[model samples]
Target: MPIRYFIKQWLMPPGLLLLLLLGAWWLRKRRPRLALACFVAGLGGFWLMSLPLVVEQVARQLETEPPLSVQAWSGLAGRADAIVVLGAGRERGDLAWGGQDQPTGTALERMRFAAQLAKASGLPVLTSGGLHYGTPPSEARLMADRLRDDFGVVVKWQEEGSRTTWENAQMSAAVLQPLGIRRVVVVTQAWHMQRSRWSFEQAGFEVVPGPVGFLGQDHGRPFAGLLPDNRAIWQSGQLLNEVAGLVGYRLFY
Candidate 1:
């Protein structure tokens, strides 16, 4: 794993909470008051992460991009030059596909939406992502293959050297700028649209947000909506990461 990944995991949720719990255990008797404080803070953080409302609120803030109707999708080509499906990740070789790399679930979600947008608009597409953990098959390759094979849409551009959102925009610019494709229909998850839009705009594309997989929702059950759920924990983690990225992007860029 990368050092940055480790640093992020340790500094963020679960890991940080675990460290607090360990501190509380080690100093329970030696420092009773401090131990109690650590225990409370650790458990409190965990509880907050486990709630669906927490995920909803964080995602809602960043998912400011409005949804595009099917009617509007077909009209995109009139306003936008092409479709840009931002790569999420690859599933790394799986036994089901005979050990071939496949698009991750998140990647598939983006592909599914992009497929519709492309089919409706009849526009060329671009898939952006790079290698993972130093692996060969780039994320762009995986997305391109899936888009062609599964969706029957040819990807005109494959940006295979970008690892971050910032790089995605910068590297995509290298491929798109020369072609005079400045107006793009940017596709990604609704929660990530903010940073994605900022990065793409910085790269000089007039962004037409095509946000999919909205996260904010009401679970319908009172306890299930607010209680400790494993899925909510993951959503919370993703939302927290996006929030951090937004702040970092604003500060640095």
Candidate 2:
């Protein structure tokens, strides 16, 4: 639907890499040199990205924040005012869930950690997300519902008009600042926490990073570490997207 979405999907791996491979195949006979170059670039990029260890190394650049200690998590009251859970995009209509859009895996992971933090901290929560391509049932609503129904935590505020992390901070600021709540615990993936913290601080909040789903940790999964995996490709894509966002936000924001 959106031009930028198309450009991004095409630029990222599987799209660009696959296109290169196809182009190589098409030109192999007439344009031997060009085809060889394309084949090497495409196959090389794909091969390098599919390794689990490679993903962790790149992710480590952004996954600097660590999880809270058990002692710190055990006593979280007075640490902050509320938990601000950032939204990941939702899954489109699915027959399994009665055609209702559901929270994406990343969103659910953030919600899971936020729930545990809220329960231990005695804090209220807010879900920040806007519509998907101007569609109804904003990500905030889906997140609020999941937090309430699945996690037993009532969302106190739903900042339902932010599509980017910058907006997440600014819109949440508009809602929270008016109420004199300037300190908050922001919850998101560890790889996302750095940029999330910077944006929220820019919007005037004392941010407490509540990072979850820590990545880049060596797992020593035998040969699986070096082998190509579909999931690793996806993970690498996520990390690359974050890197792009970090650079773009720093330049424009």
Name the top TM-score candidate. Answer: 1
- Checking candidate 2 for backbone clashes, the offending pairs are none
- TM-score, every prediction: 0.96, 0.93
Which residue pairs of candidate 1 clash? none
Where is model 1 poorest over a 10-residue stretch in terms of lDDT?
Answer: 216-225
Q: List ranges where model 2 is wrong by over 4 Å.
A: 26-31
Give the per-residue lDDT of model 2 (tens digit) for 119-234.
88888899999998689899999999999999999999999999899999999999999998889999999999999999999999998889988768887756858988888888
RMSD score of candidate 1 (Å) = 1.4
lDDT of 1 at 21: 95
Candidate 1, 1-253: lDDT as tens digits = 4998899898888889999999999999999999999999999999999888888777788889989987798899888998888888777779899989888899999999999999988989999999987897999999999899998999998999999999999998899989999999999999999999999999899999999999875656467577678988888888888998999999998
**lDDT, each prediction:** 0.90, 0.90
